[model samples]
Target: MIDSGESAVSDSILFVTHSPQRSGAESVMLDLAAECHRRGMSVSVACPVGPLSESFPPWAVHVEIPHLGRDHGRRTRAGAAWGMARSMVVAARTLRAHRGTAIVANSAHTLPALRLAGVRSVAWLVHDHLVSRKTRVFIGAGRPLLHHVVAVSPTTASALDGLVDHVAVGRLGVDIPDDAPTGALPTGPLRAGTLSVLTPWKGVDVFLEAVARLDDATAVVAGEAFPGDVGYAAQLRERAGHPDLAGRVTFPGRVRAADALAQWTVHVSASIAPEAGPLTAMEAMAAGVPVVATDHGNPRNLLADRRGVLVPPGDPVALADAMSSIAADPHGTAAMVRRAYAHVAEHHDRRETVPALLDLLLGTTSSSAPAAPADAVAAPSRGGGGSR
Candidate 1:
């Protein structure tokens, strides 16, 4: 562990982000950077810089490279690979210049270069499942190069069997003001469903299908298209006006970063594919709002038997029923709010998570695995039985 008392910091950590864009991964990195800074570590972030330049910390130095963007297809994939190699070379040179600190490689694209840079201690933070074959290959190449692989969830950790030497599960922390509104009961007919990026995996279409089934409450969707997702977003907007869904749906485009987590009554993370760990659900729980979500990815682990309702993915009937249950019972909503706040307070609180994560990064802990105590239950996927 690097010293952290009332001493001057000799170590620095370089955070490499592939997409400087304000998605969940970037948000997690920002929290980690802020936490590191608070703990007296010299910190900086490097990215293939663009519009996201404004999103960095004022005090920390920013490094820019030409290789990163929001592209995901085959041709762009080859470009990203080449760009990563060049960026890695530059990163290695920079690390040598800085000397004493560790490197926190936050993206799949930056791992190989960090390895080549020969930093004795390098930690790779993995935020999602290596779903595609290409992702698996990228991760596989970086396996031996990383000192530790930090997975955001247990399921994600389980997926990386031979990729990394050590694996740790670090859940994201949710920090909301103590004086923020609490004990909130659903008082209006307006219900909100949010996922900041409109994509197939996020189940935006599935959410709209559920909205078509709801008659009592208005469903507001918050998100916009990324570079290649404009067509999908347009189709969703068009379908929002089906005969059954016409009056109930509202597409609010994109929710601003500052207000994304705070403006909704109920947050819905309607993911069809298993996501790594969804911050929106955690944010909703922190805001004392109940959530209705599909049992895909980390929500099953996060919500368990408290604070939210889980339904089978792509099942509009089940989703509609779950939404109705939340909308019809105001008392239930209040209880869920209490449970949500309590759940996040006990597990996802910054005070608890940040320290644990620091310990892992510093090599003070033997197991990076998340502890599932008796009070905490694991969330399951679509067909898995609910935990009581």
Candidate 2:
């Protein structure tokens, strides 16, 4: 949507991502974009054509871009380099065509595009504390088109401590219910579950192993690998097929967001790697499900209160103990659920946090209070270094 004769009131925000997959990071981006649309700010998303793109609403503009392969083999790396360069130029050209549209680089893959755009885009970092050397260099260089870098987790913010000029923790927003039924637990056997992308680092194996140790609870896992990650998913299937896990572990491939969490008695997040911003965990807490997450990454920060329990990362025995403890104490679990609902409402509610995010982007200029223009109060103004 363009500014018709300079009378447009809405600000335009263009979101860029590497893949359209519904991963944790992408979910956060989509949530913010959807919230922006709700707030009457014109929103659009640019990503590779896939299932994840379908999640975007009909009202927002959709831009399909090339998929740059990863840095694995030499051939793939070369191809990715070429594709990344081309994609960056294409993204810059697309933005150049549409004036006054702020850019939000949803992934590190969009770094090249932000560099080319010249200090007009914000780097939305959701990937963990491990910032790649190349990405760090790209961010370290004071590119004119690049805006300040904002991360979804404090761990991520701390990891990138000195590399960037500006860093802020853009907390992921969750929708908390006005009221929740306390002491009303799900019927039948307790279910221990986790929502994650089907990668080894996500610790699905650990979750399955933990489930195998317990008898009273069924294990429900939700996730699927990317298009070409068949081997990885197949290995996970092999793990689920173990004799101890027979009829106990169920991998419902890529169910709707929060579907697994809502049904389960106690939600689990067993990521071995340092998590950035976990949308499923946030959604589960918002839904009043008691969470048992790894004591690492964003979960460690979110589960500061007695809302949920935490275990050592990658330890199946510890996870099993946590799950067992929660299952045994029904009253305690119910109380924890209430605390979780309150915690999410106080920190992550959308009615408050969504506008705060918009302010973060709009206030990225040299001036502390970069006010939206009179006509574009519905959206952000076309100020310098306005985030994408």
Alpha-carbon TM-score of each model against the true structure:
0.82, 0.83
Clashing pairs in 2: 20-52, 103-388, 104-388, 118-144, 118-145, 119-144, 119-145, 119-146, 120-145
Candidate 2 at 216: error in angstroms? 3.6
| Model 1 root mean square deviation, Cα atoms | 6.2
Candidate 2 local lDDT, 1-388, one digit each (tens):
2221222233777777876576767766777787678767788887777787887778878887765435333366667677667766876565455445766767666666655555344535445567677665544442344454566657776666555545666666677778764745688887887878888778888888898888767888787887566677888789878888777888888786556666888888898887875767778888878889999877777787677899999899999999888878999888888877777776777666566655554443223232321111221222333222
lDDT agreement with native, every candidate: 0.67, 0.68
lDDT of 1 by residue, 229-295 (tens): 8888888988987787777778777675336555556677788888776777777787777788888
Evaluate residue 224 in candidate 2 and report its C-alpha lDDT on the 0 to 100 scale.
83
Cα-lDDT of candidate 1: 0.67
After superposition, candidate 1 runs with Cα above 4 Å error? 1-10, 68-100, 116-120, 177-184, 256-265, 364-388
Which candidate comes out best when scored by lDDT? 2
Clash pairs, model 1 backbone: 300-379, 301-379
Give me the displacement of residue 376 in model 2, in angstroms: 29
Worst 10 residues of 2 by lDDT: 373-382
Superposed by TM-score, candidate 1 places the C-alpha of residue 352 at a distance from the truth, in angstroms, of: 3.3
